[model samples]
Target: MTINAGRHFVTIDESAAGERLDRALAAALPALTRSRVKALIEGRRVALAGGQTIEEPSRKVKTGERFEVDIPEPEPAEPVPQALALDILYEDGDLLVLNKPAGMVVHPAPGNPDSTLVNALLAHCGNSLSGIGGVRRPGIVHRLDKDTSGVMVVAKNDRTHVALSKLFAAHDLTRIYQALVWGAPKADRGRVEAAIGRHPVDRKRMAVRKSSGRNAITDYWIEKRFGPPLHPIASLVGARLGTGRTHQVRVHLAHLGCPVVGDPVYGRKSRNAKAPAALVDFARQALHAAVLEFRHPTTGEEMRFATELPQDFSKLVQSLNSVK
Candidate 1:
């Protein structure tokens, strides 16, 4: 059972031409149970563009229509206890700031119903959680990618929840990150002004588009650069974020012709050195949410918190340093 499960969007293809909606998904994702697919379809969780729910799994899906399937993580063998180690950066009666580690799931789902940050908070906070999210699980104001380790904040009561949610929506909350990219940008520091929306072709990924999307922006600076001297190239570099969107840092860096190191989707083998065995061994993208700052939900006092880079990301930079 996966401790964390990521939601992936799939677009219907010509090969899936005239197949039943559920059948197509079940075929594409053989790992998903037919019953689960059936449940999702019957419950109208499958949606078409414009966010209308689609039922009738057997309904022949039309090409070019996007569909989202919430892939639940497999349930754990035993419930993960509430005692997992959590790095609490700051805390008050109304809210708590946590430095979430990489690989920790934020909440529960079909396959991953236990051992998540929610389960831990249920144990840790115990009866203090705000119910305003109303069965959306814990009061999660925002989220970090499962592999993206960094700081996050949670509210403890209803009033606090509203305030915190507004802060995120208004972009008043200060969110910053550090990332190691595959190559260096032309400018040391610059703003990436791009509109982001689901990919036109690959719905599973988000891309910067010329038209039709939300305003997405990212600002970055080169912390370091690396590559072999003999066949020199800037193989590694670091960056920060000015805005947060799904895969924003990865997409922005990729758009600049420098995807994050070890990023499977954005960084292809050709633009990067596949010949170097050491480079290929790199794991997930090298990125970390380094700081988050905002005012206290109830008290109205300003608060700021920070987290150190996790070991995997730290070691990756060290490896890059060794090459030069």
Candidate 2:
């Protein structure tokens, strides 16, 4: 049988004989699902070897018969692209790294249907994004919270996406964050090892629980202490994640009795009230993904990136320093 561009040809073997056309095609084309195969057949894009179109998804297949399926290009993403400015750090054919600013949602959700990082990426990458993640999250392998600002990487194709996902699952990548907390730790460095799950009463928040939830761990060190020597009001800390769970860093920090400053959900109101007015005025969590390290998916080269604090965070730190 002759092969052509944008078409896949498969010959039915004895093992596939007498099976429904959709089922047979699904086995032949592992990349396409049964539903997708049915859609193709219904679209009249599947034909027998002799050019006889097969529109019936349930038609029985015969042994030794060959069929061809015309593969369609992926459709445009559903999210509308806006001319949003992006802080791109690096880019190539396989992937891109960007500094995601605070207040930008990663993807569209119930309340946020546009102006997300996904929508911006759709416009930035255009048709180059990997469709494996579907239309809503094209090329997205992981996410950062809307209020957290820092470095993030995005895949441009399926191979890179799968590779990055595996790396994240194995915890083989490096993600380091810097945060300002309300109080200094008794010890300069320590680790928080706990299980994290959705809060029982508050579905939107994560809590440290022993009986339920995924194991989460964070290693942190005090970078600097602010305020009077005997009564330090705040501390700047660096945290490294061992397990990436929802709100893992914030939950672990709060569990350690040093909730991040400006974290409305996990921070204590009394502690926030004691902070300098400039620091208290900060709206979002005082956390930034300062460093990211990983190996290139295709080249195996070690890649590392770091970002400076945003203006708001820098100014807040300055305010704390002045009041110290």
Candidate 3:
């Protein structure tokens, strides 16, 4: 009944009878998570006493029977593991920090059922991820929108989850984003302090509100200008969040009359005005999470991570250069 790397046999007792197969296995083998047990069973790795393979996770357990589980090696895992590749920036026993690419949903939802960051982490980190609703699920403390790419940190266990959540709640960590906006800010540097909430007419869009919204702040500065300096057409801007809000950067920037380039929902000044075709006809929002800094939850070590702009973003910037 003890769980160690060496023990693989689970002998069911009267208390375990009628319990679900995966549940029983996880209770008996504490080293392996319930989700992992389910995967192993579905992968045809666990067998009953008479060598009969049990593939149903919900199968009821019977007393006085023994089940053997086959744990796969860490590397060269089989088809049971999701095949999505991960750009793991840093990993420890308690956390995983990575650069989540643009267009990938962070969590599984109705429209996005699989092939998400959580699914990939479930495969990549294996049994290391644990604790959600009393089962072993990845702890996603914060998330970026599917279209917004950036640096993110994921907790691997409950302790790390609590710590990271506290850090975000206090706004103790630093987050920086780089964006290509429609025009340069009036001033070199300025701050936007407003309240943000769901749009009254369009449920899909978020807007700055005078009332009935959470306080949002974004400090922005123009990094470079494109086109004639006196009357620039576009600018690359860096924005640091004073408060993390849904669509904070996009909505705040758009409120400033400088919507992010390629933002179809917000950059609606003039439709089909996507001039210079190459520079304007972007497929998704031209924003990226450029920098993230946080202290290690368990180790108290100062950690910082940054990622380069994707090829498309780089090319867009290059195209903007010629129009300068």
Candidate 4:
């Protein structure tokens, strides 16, 4: 990778031959994902050698081919504050515990510039922040993916940030999520241990990799099955993350043949095509971070918090229970 006049350039090598145009380029630019690269290609922000612009992300590239990519300048440095409501469970001088709603991005990003948790924190914390969010990020020690409702802990100072970061890295805390999945597991409870990494061919999604992937584990229990005994339509599951990776609970449950209902990315819709209308009409992934437990960074005392299911989630459960 090389930079010239605010543009990033990558020369394809023998190793990258026959790779998808977006995949090859994204591999060179670690900061960009294939989906983002695809967006750039379609937006005419990517060009090939000899000053030829390309707009096809699927086009395969060969050795000796080179591409130039133009990344637009970022919008701003610090996120502007917003007066968003927060469900604060606990707070003090060094840290805060709150229930983050689904559909709220944890921080500001390209398309989502404001109304994020970080923006809300800026307004709520006022001048008390210690600037631990790093340049482009906020002081979030961990994240519950956007659209994943849950309890999260935010740092107010740098010391707390580092301490929480180390604790999460070591997997010394507890995280349990509740999800409504399409089918019940064969047993009452089980554990899934798999290594996850970017899908090799489809760079936009993650997959369980046979090799060259990071360790991930999820322990789950079948709390209740909502349909017939032999062939249940869906189940309420309690999942404990032994290790947290991106989409860990969703992916692992999908691997267990029980994809979370309303999960667009990893669900098997055809399998449940004839299921009741309750699940068919529901939208968004039926997953929530219900429990978060850890030791307070400064005080060294243990802490635990559990969040209630959103109203929509509760209604969905009621509908599922009424299914034949």
Best by lDDT: 2
lDDT of each: 0.72, 0.86, 0.80, 0.83
Question: What order do you get sorting by lDDT, best first?
Answer: 2, 4, 3, 1
Is candidate 1 or 2 superior in lDDT? 2
Candidate 3 per-residue lDDT over residues 1-324, each given as its tens digit = 434432277899999999999999999888778998999888656767434556689999999889877664442212233658888888888888898888998776556666788778878878767555133136788899888887999888888889998999889999999999887789989999999865644445678978556789899999999887876778899999989988899999999988998897887542434346765668889999999998998889999999999888888888878884
What is the C-alpha lDDT profile of model 1 across 12-104, one tens digit per residue? Answer: 888887998888887766767678788877754465644544668888977776777655445444333377788888777788889998888
TM-score to native of every candidate shown: 0.72, 0.75, 0.72, 0.79
Q: Candidate 2: which stretches are off by over 4 Å?
A: 1-77, 271-274
RMSD of 3: 14.9
RMSD of each: 7.5, 13.7, 14.9, 7.6
Please report how far candidate 1 places residue 214 from its true position, in Å: 0.5
Q: Provide the lowest-lDDT 10-residue window in model 3.
A: 72-81
Clashing pairs in 4: 133-138
Q: Report clash pairs, candidate 2.
A: none
